[model samples]
Target: MNPTTTALRAGCSRGLIELRQSLTNAGELLNHVLWPVLMLVTLFFVRDVSFGQSGFLLGTLVLPSILGMNAAMALVTMSHLLTVDREDGTLLRAKSTPNGMVTYLVGKIISVSGGLVVDLAIFLVPGLFIISGLAVGSVGSWLALTGLLALGLAATLPIGAVLGSVFTSARDQGLLTLPILGMIAISGVFYPVTSMPEWVQWTAQVFPIYWMGLGMRAALLPDSAVGVEIGESWRHVETVCALGAWAVLGLLLAPVVLRRMARRESGSAVARRRERAQRRVS
Candidate 1:
């Protein structure tokens, strides 16, 4: 194979292996089951209403929003996985070899992005049938929703890279998870941002999560989901514009951040960290 193809394959393989390993170690099955089970149980016994009537009034809308959260979570986990590999000396060994760093990183992105796609399908497909009917209207609306989802994932990558660079161990992941999940909760994933304090709504708008949720809502829900004026005009166009801007910004910054991380990763640093851990455990 050509060098480019070979590099892509190597990167993809490494990424896939890491992704699977991370999921198994992290209880990926528990997470998947937890979300849908919580959602369905609340819908059936806890709430007398149909899916739409439950407090999740936007059941049709919530699926895509959750999918966006899934994308962000997947990217964040991938970032942490990469960091663990680096910390354990895998990255140092690979750096000493003929395998290119760029290829490996690209493979990581591809592998994680593939996992995100699968996660979305797993959540949304059965969700459409079970919770609420898929009602995006025409083929065009479906296309727009798909585009929004892809762009949202693009926007999530840089943030994930930054998080991965900062955090080191499973303990760190536990501490960081709450903050990240809080960000999502406040980002209007569960309800309209307008319901929050003005300051909270303003804060939510600053993150890609808000735009991702808004974009998904725009795509899935009917015009009624937004304000009357916004619904009348079909505000998805604005969502596209806003999300596109975030996607562009994330793309521009992700590589620079990742390169800085690669530069910081070294055999000596990995060894020191490992030695310290050993000392602590002993």
Candidate 2:
């Protein structure tokens, strides 16, 4: 059998093992259930509230937007987990093995993306009951949603790996939380992007976050809701283009970034990071 093919198979098995472990881990289980449950509570409260004069329920608008935000969040998860593995010397272990880095990355992407899918289902399933007015009954809605998420994951996961590569420590990765939150704020996950300033709209468009949210909205919202979006349209073409571009960029950058980061890893470096972490704790 081919070495690369063998590595891919190993990576897939590794990812599944980690995912199963997470499902059983008490802390990990809580983390998975918590956010989506909170989101459902939020959606429940807003189910009847109107979004300005748009006649659309705020809950309706927010539900899919939350889905988009969650999808984009795959980047954060990928980066955080990678950084944590690096700090704990797991990455160093991988570097010692043949084609281990590639295996490591594939496993992480699968683990993270799998977790996202579970979280998405948690939110979306109950969310359909909690909110009214979304186009939930159609096959098209499901197809659009499935495609958007697949693309969004493809778009964000490698970028997350790049971030993880650049930010060598968990503390360094922590610094990104604020900026990501700020991006979510402007990405119109919690609100309409058209309501933001024109410059804000343009700036947000440059990132995948906005496109993910837009894609989610297009998938789940009724056609009438398009009036509130930029250009009074869902801009499906633009959504695909923006997300496709990011997907390309991430795929291009991840290997280069990961290879560079992997080359820099050593037992001594891992020891130093652990020492620093211990010092911080003390």
What TM-score against the true fold does each predicted structure earn?
A: 0.80, 0.98
Q: Which ten residues in a row have the lowest lDDT in candidate 1?
A: 46-55
Q: Give the candidate number with the greatest TM-score.
A: 2
- Which residue pairs does candidate 1 place in steric collision? none
Tens-digit lDDT track of model 1 for 1-282:
787788878887777886676467658656645665565543333222323332344455556566556665655766776677777877666666665675667767876786666666656666666655445558876887788767776777656766676766544666777777888888866555666777887787677777777777667766554551222344566666776786687668777876776777787888888987788789
In lDDT terms, how accurate is model 2? 0.90
Q: Tens-digit lDDT track for model 2 on 7-107?
A: 89999999998999999999999999999999899888878888788988888898999999999999999999999999999999999999898788888
Cα misplacement distance, residue 25 of candidate 2 (Å): 0.6
The lDDT per prediction is 0.66, 0.90
Candidate 2 TM-score versus the reference: 0.98
In model 1, which regions exceed 4 Å deviation? 16-56, 133-137, 228-234, 280-282
